[model samples]
Target: MPSTSTSLSPLSTGLARATAGLNLCHENASEVWHQRPPLDFLQIHPEHLIQEEGGTYRDQLDDLRHAYPIVLHGFGLSLGSCAPLDQDYLQLVKRVLKEHPEAFFSDHVSWSSLSHHHFHDLLPLVMNDETLDYLVERIDQAQELIGQPILLENISSYMRFRDSTYDEPSFINALTERTGAYVLMDVNNLWANAVNFGENPLTQLMEYRQSSVRGYHLAGCTRQQAGDGDVYIDYHGEAVHETVWDLYEKALRHFGPWPTLLEWENHVPPLERTLQEVSRITRYLNDLSVAPGAT
Candidate 1:
């Protein structure tokens, strides 16, 4: 059976500090550590781990699993779509999990493709009673197929439906309450949505069922202003903003310390820079734990 718990070994604090200045794209992933920097966790995109020309991918995963704790973050599970679940994709995911028994498996809460049309980005779902019922049943089926509990991540969306009745937090809370699945909260996405949609992100966080959150995501974003409109995009490049850090601090206070992942997908910086961001978040987490009256 696939393992549900993360490993107990402490990430290399010294390596995390030493590479706190390196560029991410320039460095080869294989040479990420001269000293094997302590990583909080290494997240692999599921597609990257299991391609048809799968020899190198399998070898790399084998090497990675031996060195650090790994988590499988999938991009293709369209959990909220009206369409049926992709059995082939689920089978591949199951195979990967079977191979890496120690890794935690997770995917997004939003839907992607529908009716043979594939959208590369995670799109928002209409929040309603019908959608809620569909999601709960889908979550139950997915958990049974995967043979382990899956973490569903809240995704960033560029649009919302006028007909939608439920807000994001209430929808998520209801899903967790009914399905018993854990949440993978993405702080940058929440902040981006707040800036774009004029909703207070902190208020949404407060309304969420905190006990359902299993992990958190921190990423960099880009801000754009055109005419009277301004938007913050979850670009996952550059350094994380002060606003994101503040939100993360608030999240730590609300949900307590959970596994946090710093994502830098586009404009991959040096490994050191990524490590620095992770280090910074870790410092804040440590500080939060030591603060007076902190639980």
Candidate 2:
């Protein structure tokens, strides 16, 4: 049987205390239907769930929708691109949202396309005033078209732009302030960047300096030793690391809990193994949700 606990939103007090359950990728929908683990929600990638020939959604996902609440995580919104917003793609996304009006939508802060050509990766961005202004304008445009506010997630980057002005966290804080946007914090990504950039992960987050977390993302990345030193890759594969868990503990301690996600991007694990991971996370969340003050 599924746990009685429900997913917590940033607006909810419980979110501050943790207590949110597991949210898995749509690829695990079938497994979830069979196993019926205590899940909070299922995340659907827009890139994967395209419309059918009849202009309707893939009917197969209907079962998953009926089983659990869906949250839309976009890969191709390209809000960071210099090119104009892709109206056709946005319409498709809006249509899907209409089908599931209750679903929350989000995408990475990084650009995945340029000059109408997609790189298919969450490419890094410069955190200068120009980039900030560009992204804020596009976020406003995206929110207007989507008919709801959207969350922008921090993307893991291996390189930094020379033209960058403010730090990533500062830019995000300003971005949200300028556009009334929310954030989906990826702790692992921050940790990876910290490891690679020689900065403290907690300091990276604390610089945001506001409770701007609308959602949270957790995934594991492998570390490789290079000629220069060590570098961490945000591959979203493998099990969660203790260091990342420690960062998460600090995040929960400071910001409390928001709607958190466990991304099983590649090197997929079996359904049973995924279940064990979720159970472990749930126990941690349950322990943490009982914060300093509340019951």
Candidate 3:
């Protein structure tokens, strides 16, 4: 049985909390546990641990809980949806956090559900004042229910809404200003969007200083044919791109080396191979630590 406490402690509240981490995948979990890769913390989608309805804990979750500090990243909240927040989903999230009270949880700034239908991919939001107000209300309710502030991640968007009033950083800044939610800055997604949309990643990163960014996601994407042009899809199925790594180092210089996790979801690889990606993060952190003017 898990604890019933509602207290949520800040895991990476301070600057430079940890350098490298891995997203615990279901397929490689047993091997990861047996091999015990060197990670500062382990992240999991809490949706994987508890059943949607019964809220029962899986044995694997219990095992992992005893091994390392957990960070919960979720995709089902649909925080930007016009459809009301799913009470059952909120309950499921609350249940997991109650047990792993030290864990900090996060979800996307986009929607996955519309009315009763659920989409497999995270869809983009309009990014206007109307959407911002709706998200603020829902995020407030969720924080009240979950007993802590939530981190919201920016998703990779294929297209932008014409009526959007704010740029990505400005939109996220407004949300953090209004609701006090932290950010799980996905550097790869930023790079993907930059490539797909003709934007500058480093410039946007400097503008992202307004939010409380506590974590980072580094992953690879696929370049797919979009008619006559090439669009980068955030597949998270390959190695971290060189462009993303360059931006990540700039981000570390800007954001002070927050807990960075390597997310390899699609074609999951061996634990050692996965750790190699994490090792890159380690090398960057090591260099940054000794760099001039670094604290």
Between prediction 2 and prediction 3, which has the larger TM-score? 3
* Residue 251 of model 3, lDDT score: 85
What C-alpha RMSD separates each model from the true structure? 6.0, 6.8, 5.1
Worst 10 residues of 1 by lDDT: 11-20
- List candidate 3 segments past 4 Å from native: 1-16, 51-58
The per-model lDDT (C-alpha) reads: 0.72, 0.73, 0.80
Per-residue lDDT for 195-269 in model 2, tens only? 899998888988775567777788889888877788888887788889988888777767766667777757877
Cα displacement (Å) at residue 174, model 3: 0.4
Q: Kindly list the per-residue Cα lDDT of model 3 for residues 117-173, writing each as its tens digit.
A: 879999999999888888888888888787778898999999898999999999998
Per-residue lDDT value at 105 in model 3: 85
Q: Tell me the tens digit of each residue's lDDT in model 1 across 169-218.
A: 88888776776677878899888887788888898788888788777888
In model 1, where do residues sit more than 4 Å from their true spots? 1-28, 31-35, 55-58, 98-102, 293-295
By TM-score, the best candidate is 3
Q: Give the C-alpha miss distance for residue 47 in model 3, angstroms.
A: 1.3
Residue-pair clash count for candidate 1? 11
